[model samples]
Target: MSFARYVEQTDPPRPPRETLPTMYDLPSENPEEPGLPDEFHDFQPELLRITFQPPTHLPEQVFSASDMNLYYNVRYPNWYKRPDWFGAVGVPKLYEGRDLRLSYVIWQEGVSPFVVVELLSPGTEEEDLGRTKRRNDQPPTKWQVYEQILRIPYYVIFSRYTERLQVFILQAGHYQELNLSESKVWMPDIALGLGLWQGEYAGIHRLWLRWYDAKGNWISTEAEQERQRAEQERQRAEQERQRAEQERQRAERLAERLKALGINPDDDL
Candidate 1:
């Protein structure tokens, strides 16, 4: 059935949108699921969000969040997965383009995430890699949902401790792991690439996964761009100061030559 048919609410007297559990009503966090508790989780995903600039999408049309509940199943609306980071284009940054989304409800939004990232931690490593088996009565595993159900185009896993990046792309209705011959992998669909870079982020110097442009240049954050501009301005000012000093010295030498000729240096003034 079409997603619109699932949430059809034209009958006025009782609109399903109004009656259904909106993001507001759904539980934000599921304590039963194993959660990755690390400060790296906070910083890495934040960097992804800052540099996630999709050339084809407007700023308001791009939406991404970390550790946010993503409600995917219409049958069990309460079921959700909190990804380390997930991003989608062609969706409003705000829920319904007005309110902030407490959770991303697939039926209501009608858009599945284009990419989902899982930061590897010891607790969730097996499941994140889709190595765990689920019983018939149990809810589907993360891999099953992303590959067989949501069919997210790109699934990324980054390890902070190992600084390893493993990317899987959906092909033929299944995820085929891309060979990471190098540290970087390009996503032609998104017109960007993800790579491991050794740099200082959030005051910590280490290899962090970040996005790069089609030209293979790392995308700069707003703050990083601002700092670069300021440094350029400073260099320009310094060059101007040096030019003025050279002109002043030339004038002094001309004045000395005029004095030797017995001509008043101030006469030109």
Candidate 2:
């Protein structure tokens, strides 16, 4: 089917929620899928979601998901892609501004992802990087869905095993690999930069793909921010205590000097 025709029909979509399966009706997962969420898969996306704050968008206008089924086609309502993590700006935090989304239906939502991240695993490395070919009947690979169908602005892949980061941007109607300096790429549209940071996430000390602010500071997780605030408070308290102690010592010296000069230290003025 032509893309134009798909659009014509989907403007008042008949194949998605009203006529065909919606997120609530569609099955989210299959045990047969090659790549499944492991420990890192769980932690990394959580970190991404927490740290992703677009300067231009409101909190309600930005939404991020991990391992959620993203249905793209109105023609093929069952066709879906489960990106490791995807962020969409200018979309409701809930499905249609009220209900929580069980899955991200592109046709229904009427927006493509701003950025999609695929956490590479050994089992799915070939397909994740667009190396493997799909049979004619199979749904398009993750690359085709994100790059061609969805036309997502940014595509990112990170491998924990090798500690490598790769970013691709849609250019000239195709994805072009971007040259990264220090394993970092800035998405100006999103007003955020992503890079590899050597630090502890969820108590695991390793190099991880993390988001950075415009100043090149790693966006802190909520817990990390809380810790930083606590530290600041402690430092301020310590400084105040030191100042009080110094004042007390100075007052004692003045009293001693007055006593030596035959003037009672406690005398009324």
Candidate 3:
């Protein structure tokens, strides 16, 4: 019998997971060079940074970065993890109160990231999802550095292809997956929530992860706020015009009635 006919006659089929190369088997990086980010990686992080509003902190006290190398180890000083997007509350927006930081050093900053978001990429999926094993000599993996060493409070992962969002919160020194309802995760400590927003951002409209207020409303960007203000002004002007037109018609009717009664309306005026 042919191989196809024999398989069709078989009672149970073989699983692809057994034969195919798993994520672990794939190389995480090339030793010679760093990976280049795609367009989604650039745009998504910008949206998160723009909309991130920590209610309790001032604008200058909240620092959010994208594709920035975060150095965690004090001993080695060179070991770092590059997050797609990360937000740190209670930290000065400027490093040492004056300069923009090229990278975030945990030891110098003394404040760990309040939240870290990683956009899923096929090349780094294993490490991003904490599926890869850590070597004994090398520094901790990205997941280990974020969860164990840095102890970041919130870790979020989003897959563009599947449009799936996963939220993990640090509880009792461990990371626990949150059961998000409608793709929303609320952080009571920061008084803000993160959810998937469907709208145009940077001239592209799709599902983007963004911050929302406590009342479950998506936080607006500066451009969006301006657009809303302009719309409100237009509506007010329209209402005023309608009111003026009504008053003018009423005055004209009264003038005609006075003329019909043999009284000159202009003489009384």
TM-score of each: 0.89, 0.91, 0.86
Query: What are the per-residue Cα lDDT tens digits for candidate 1 across 10-108?
Result: 213433655677777888877786655978999999999998898878899999999998888776677677789999989999999899888888888
lDDT tens readout by residue for model 3, 1-269: 53224334642553443453222332334365565568999899989999999999999999999887787755445567889999999999998888877778776788999999999989988999999887656667888788877889999999998999999999877789988778989898999999998889999999999999988999999999999999999999999999999999999999999999998889945
lDDT of 2: 0.86
Which 10-residue span in candidate 3 carries the lowest summed lDDT?
A: 20-29
Writing each residue's lDDT as its tens digit, candidate 2 over 1-269 gives 74344455555435435576666787777667865558999989988999899888999999999999899877777788888999999999998788988889887788999999999987779988988765655766778778778899899999988888989999976789998877999888878998888899889998888889999999988899899999999999999999999999999999999999999989898
Clashes of 3: 0
Which pairs of residues collide in candidate 3? none
The ten-residue window of minimal lDDT in model 2 covers 4-13
Prediction 2 TM-score vs. true: 0.91
lDDT of each: 0.85, 0.86, 0.84
State how far residue 146 of model 2 sits from its true place (Å): 1.1
